[model samples]
Target chain A: MATVRAALVQEASAQFTSRQPLVLVVDDDPDVRASLQDMFESVSLETAVFESTAEMLQHGIPDRPCCLVLDLRLPGTGGLEFQAQLREMNQFVPIVFITGHADVATSVRAMKAGAIDFLPKPFRQQELLDVVSHALRTEGEKHRDGGERNTVRRLGESLTPRETDVLRGVARGLLNKQIAYELGITEITVKMHRSSAGRKLKSISVADMLRKIDLLGI
Target chain B: MATVRAALVQEASAQFTSRQPLVLVVDDDPDVRASLQDMFESVSLETAVFESTAEMLQHGIPDRPCCLVLDLRLPGTGGLEFQAQLREMNQFVPIVFITGHADVATSVRAMKAGAIDFLPKPFRQQELLDVVSHALRTEGEKHRDGGERNTVRRLGESLTPRETDVLRGVARGLLNKQIAYELGITEITVKMHRSSAGRKLKSISVADMLRKIDLLGI
Candidate 1:
């Protein structure tokens, strides 16, 4: 397995560049890791091969847009346990698991743990590529949403309770008059709150503020 | 299989009086279909089970909001062929596949054909329920978008090509001045196009028009 990891990294160094999305490949079997690296690199994705879960954690994961192609049978920590650890660390990067011993119980558990897809061993290159692409796209969307939500949270952290209420109403697509009526305030007061909230958030338009709120899902 | 179909229909009939979402379970195995019907019914979803592809096609899928839990190893047409047929008919209903022999190639192929998820045989009841819920939610979103798009298309069909172009630009988050600059037209002409397009689409504001356009992904 160690040989497999070294060989995969060597091969990936020759084939993939930093421009492509990085994929971490974790499997105990050397052959499996090498094959996966070859397959993903063929699609122009950077691949990092790890022989075990310990190695993966020790090597440290990159903060770039990436995903995992993990094998269920690992040496140190099993795939399912590793998945739990990753979730505990709040690493929501998408994962696609490959397993030789296919079973309903394991697959179901994996899906419930937020796996993007699970493939049995001896998969075709196209099959792997398609799943990887889907995982990458899903991760990208999620990462973008996370960034927007962070921005929204930072912007909203300083708002007063009343102003936050007004912001929620605005985010829900309420008009000024409607918000004023709902809040039992005059339209002029509602306008004042809106302007103040906008200034505090550094947003120029209601739409931009709403977009941020939408990202926050509030 | 026939017994499963009967049980599913009975379950569906019982639930149809309420507003629960319906699910169509297509499989050749009686036990599999029966299990799925029980699982779905437990979660307050209607289930209609069929023994074969021909039976499903003969019954004619309902226009109501629904999804399919298809079996990969069907008697005649099989899962992949049925999926292709559904795609050919332009049906975008989400599917969750059940397979006795799960493999990477088969799962990937099903996903590419728009399956929301796949579970191997002997799956947990909660597993099926979770995937079904996700699939229904996704299909619901798509249906809502499709309804909005249909209304927009009906209205946009009456517009001239230039008006449609301006409408698209508005949907793409462009201002009238920016659209005019991009199209090499006067802002007045752009406003005229926007107003005409909005009136034709029965929209009151640029925001509504933009929402419709976003729903249509144009």
Candidate 2:
């Protein structure tokens, strides 16, 4: 009984330690990475620092619940391009972009690409920590609920070509009769397609369906 | 027919005139407000400048779609508090916060509170314009969407007590069986509640549901 109790305690401890979210810090500057690592650690997080985006990609990101702390300027592929690549790969980990100047155009573009937060250079330690904490917590929650998310994404992708056409028309605020006229189908047929598409996307309302389509940017 | 044609011409002219979105500039400093008004008008946007929040609020906001250009420090209910009030009143017009000092803590707090962007004192003209343009465009899109986002927010707010409990547990990474046991409900019932909450929130997946919850900090 004592041995069994000891084993249970060990298992609980392992689970607790494993639950600490990991953060990947990718910046060319060693000092920045070190400081961020220290800050994240102080908050009971585990962090890995990479000097370049190349180094980060080479190491192959771990499957552990994680987020990327990325610098806006990097060697080779630049930050913006890297972000574009991540989006193309459907890697939706929350990103906190760090930059020297908060250029308005660049910031707008980054936000449109789904970056969670942006911090200008010479930012306060607490500001960085706060954003990082928020980002990691967000990523951790995503990891926890990834199963349902992937299922939805997959279901959205599996939509038939005709259903997708119907969806785009719906998103344009087309009425059911209008969609049927455009698609050369009966109104009843339009309703059937719409219902099927919504079921696959796990969406119940037309507005919800439109929002999911927007999120996928399709 | 002639009168109708003349009225149509006048309406077309008004549409052209209203192409440039109006901006409400709120700052206590006359020079700053005037300078901003001049700058924005040069870019063809309409500007209404005020020296205080009270003045702007009293004058009543513009009837057309608009965003606020706010100074962090004001006479009475300051920028931060005004922002809080705006959110409480569910007036989600985008805000661009300007400050004379580079207060990181305040800036982060403002960003977390949904300020579209933050600009420090001595910002370049282009920087200010860039942020304003983005804010205006975002606000215009929201208006054009006919308040679809408000529907999402309202649905998110309507989660039942049991659903909220299940959502928190799901965010914390509990499996369905685990949540069922924790809530003392059948697993089928847990599934029903989870699906219902997700539907109500217009979330296609658990991750999306969690993201909405995190955004609302519920």
Candidate 3:
């Protein structure tokens, strides 16, 4: 196990410089770790394998979008307990649990606590890969240009009530006349509000305004 | 089953006149439905019981905050399949699955597809009630005053960039001078922006501004 851990760390460190999405695996069984390492690496995903939650915590979470593939029945702290611990520590890492001893109650508990997906052991390689891709994509969305989001949010905060209503209607694909009818305003007023909103948001096109509205998440 | 369903409908119709959150139950066994109906009503909760998804659909979803308590293995459409069908129809009612045939795969699938809770048969009454309360609470959040949300969002959309920054800092509990320092502006400028934002939002107090910020869900 020591030699396997050392080899895994060396391989992971070598791949870390590439800044690719990471998949962290924690299983007491060395063979399972090796198999997962090979499987994730086959899809060009970097992996850091550990024998227990303690070891993974010791190494600390990588500063990258990553998902944890955890074994349900670990040596010391179980996967569910470790998940709670991470939550208490405010580490919101996505987790996918695998277990040979699958039970409905435990699976329900894990899902209720926000495990991304739970897979019974001897699962398909494709299933695991697809779930990992989904988890990574969710994490990536959170990590995307924070500065850009702040700017968009600030711009969204700059509209008047009428301008916001016009833009939101536009975002919903409403025509200016339809917006006017909905708001009980004239079409000319709708146009004025639309153009004024565009100016305030510094957006040149309807598509750009739509994108900004999406960013506001209304 | 027809007689049992009729009795259930008659009882439910009598209770529907009162405006209360409804709990819809669909289970094949008459005994189970009766038990659930009694349990829910014992706590003063309104319930509509059905033997299958077809029957529930025919009865129609209640026009208020509600949740579905579905049996996993029905004679016709199963619980998980019915959940998918509901999503297809865009009903989005929260669901809690109760099944005698407990399995990991199905539980995980149900949870992944957005089930509020999955319970194996012969579960505790309190556990089921707690989960139902949670589901109803979630549904209630969505049904909250849409007009108020629109008003708050429009007010949020009316803040200038600097005013937004100042207010966001305030919402995070930062002092006015600290916000000024962070924004590379003077303390007086921070106060000016804050006052302007308060007036624009029609929020007379810091607490009101904070509530508005929360409503914007930033």
Top lDDT hit: 3
Interface RMSD of the predictions, in order shown?
4.9, 12.0, 14.1
Q: Write the per-residue lDDT of candidate 2 for residues A34-112, one digit (tens) a residue.
A: 8899998998888999988788788876655677888999888777888888788777767878988566557645665
> Worst lDDT window (10 residues) for model 3 chain A?
A10-19
Candidate 2 residues lying further than 4 Å off, grouped into runs, are A1-20, A27-46, A60-64, A71-92, A96-131, A143-146, A152-218, B1-20, B42-44, B103-109, B121-127, B147-218
Q: How do the residues A69-177 of candidate 1 rate in per-residue lDDT, one tens digit apiece?
A: 8999877799999999999998877888898886665775677577777788766778778878887776666666555565567567667788877877776557788
Worst 10 residues of 1 chain A by lDDT: A11-20
Position B140, candidate 3: lDDT:
68
Least well predicted 10-residue stretch by lDDT in candidate 1 chain B: B11-20
What lDDT does candidate 1 reach at residue B24? 95
Docking class of 1: incorrect
Give one digit per residue, the lDDT tens place, for model 3 in A82-143. Answer: 99999999898999999998888999999999998999989998999999989998787765
Name the better of 1 and 3 by DockQ: 3
Backbone atom clashes (below 3 Å) for every candidate: 0, 0, 1
lDDT of 1 by residue, B67-169 (tens): 8888899778998999899989988777888888986557755664567777887678787788888878766666665555665765666788898889777
Please give, for residues B24-116, the per-residue lDDT of candidate 2 as tens digits. Answer: 999999999999999999999889999888888898755456879999999998999999998887787789888886555467567767877
Q: Comparing candidate 1 with candidate 2, which one achieves the higher TM-score? A: 1
Candidate-wise lDDT, in order: 0.77, 0.77, 0.85
Q: What is the CAPRI rating of model 3's predicted complex?
A: incorrect
